[model samples]
Target: MTVSRTRRAWIAGLMLALAGGLTPARADEPVTVFAAASLKNALDEASAAWTQETAKTTRISYAGSNALAKQIEAGAPADLFVSADLAWMDYAEKNGTIRSETRVNLLRNAIVLVAPKGSTQKVALEPGVDLAKALAGGRLAMGNVEAVPAGKYGKAALEKLGAWDGVRTQVAQAENVRAALLLVARGEAPLGIVYATDAASEPGVEVVATFPEGSHPPIVYPAALTKESRNADAAAFLTYLRSPAARPFFERQGFGVIGTEKRS
Candidate 1:
C-alpha cells in the first residue's frame, strides 16, 4: 500500500527521532544552527556525538559570524547561533534576534601568526616588531578587518604592537578566518593571522607565534537560541554542546570551553 505523502513524512521524522534517541517534537524538523566558519570541525564532531547519543539531528550552517548575524537579522530560520566573538552575539542581542535568556559565553580562543607547515619564519608579536620586514615581501592574510572577528582581532593586536600602520598595505584580507588559513596553507600568502584552533585544524600550517593576550580583546565564542527557533530540541542540543561529552571534541580541536554565563 502506498502511504500518503504527509504520512510518509511523519514516518521518516519518527525514524530519525528514534535513531537520535530523542522524543518526537511537534514537528520532525531538525534543529538549525548558524555558526562561525572556524567552528566547522569541532562543532560538526560535537553535533555528531549529540545525534549519536540523543537521536536528535542538527542542521548547521557555517560562515563568517558577521554574515551569519546579518542573515539572522534578515529573518533566517536559525534555531541556534554560535559566534566566534562576543560582538556579533551582542549585535544579535541588541537587534532582538536571539533569546537573551538562553545566551551564554561558551568558548575561548587565542590568535596566532602562522606560516605554511615547513616555513621557518618567526617574529615576536610585541610593540615595535617589524612585521612587514619579517613578511619578506609576502602579504599577511587575515579575515576582513572591518567586519570578520578574526581579522578585527588580528588588526587590534597589530595596532597594539604598533605593527598595523607599517603592514596595512601588505595585508591580504579574506572573507573569514578559515579562508585566511587556507591562503596560508595553500602558500597563496606566506603568512596569516588566525585563531590558534584554526591553525590546529589545518595540517598544512604551523603556528609561528601567538599574539600576546594583552594585545587584543579576549576571544570568546558566544552561543544562544534564536528568537525565531521553533524546534523543541534546540535547547537540549545547546546544552549538549557544553556537556563533558562534547568537551573532548572541542578541546581536541584546540578550543577552550568557558563556563556558561547565562544572560537572563
Candidate 2:
C-alpha cells in the first residue's frame, strides 16, 4: 500500500507539471508601433481609447519618418509604421520591411509659417513673397530639409513660391518638426515652417500663414503593418485607427481624417 501511494503521488505531480507547461501565455501582449513624431499627441489618445475598449496595449516609438524608416530597414521589430509622408513609406515598402497591401493613407495636413504666440507677424504666402524680409534677420526654424518630411515640404513650398533663394541661408534646421516648433515657441527662432497641426498643438506658437496647396506635394500620413510584426492585434489596431472612435482625437489635434476634406 505504501509503494502504491508513493507511485500515485509522483504521477500526480508529473501531470501537474505537464499541465502547467501546456498552458498558453497571456494573449494580450502590446503591439509595437513606430510612428512619426508629428503623430504623437493624436496617436497617444487613440491608443489609450483602443486599450480601454479592447484590453490590448500599444507601445509607440516616435521620431522623424526618415529615421524610423531606416530603423525598420535595419530590422527593428515593429508591428506597425506610421509615416508623415508617402515617400518614406515607399522606401520601407521597397525594402520589403512593410507589408504593402496593408498600407493606407491615414491622415492629411498642411504646411504653414508660424510665429511666437502673441506676435503680430503675418505675411501672405504668395509667389515671390519675401520670406527673408519677414524674418527680420532672425533665423527661420525648420526640420532637416534634406530628409525630414516636414522640412522637405517646407522647402518645396518655399521653392515653389520663389522664396527659398532668399531665406535658405537663414534656416535653423532641427531634427524634426516638433523641435522646430519648439524653437519658435522659445523665441530662439522668430519664424518657423511646420505642419498646421503642429502649430496648433503648441500653445506658444501661432500660425502666421499657410502654404498654398499647389506649393508642394499633398501631405499624407501613411500607415502599414511591418513585415516583422508578430502581434495578433496589429491588423485590428490598424482598422481601429480608421474607426469613428479614433477619428475625434486626430481631428482634435488638427489632422485631416482620411476620406474627409477637413483642413486646419
Top lDDT hit: 1
lDDT of 1 at 167: 94
Q: Could you tell me which residue pairs clash in candidate 2?
A: none
The models' CA-based lDDT, in order, is 0.92, 0.91
Superposed model 1: Cα runs more than 4 Å off: 1-27
Cα deviation of 148 in candidate 1 (Å)?
Answer: 0.5
Model 2 score (lDDT) = 0.91
| TM-score of each prediction | 0.89, 0.88
Instruction: Give one digit per residue, the lDDT tens place, for model 1 in 1-264.
Output: 989999999899889878977555565578999999999999999999888988888899999999999999999989999999989999999999999989998888999999999998878877899999989899999999999999999999999999999999999999999999999999999899999999999999999999999999999999999987768899999999888888899999999888566543
Q: What is the C-alpha RMSD of each candidate to the true structure, in Å?
A: 5.9, 6.3
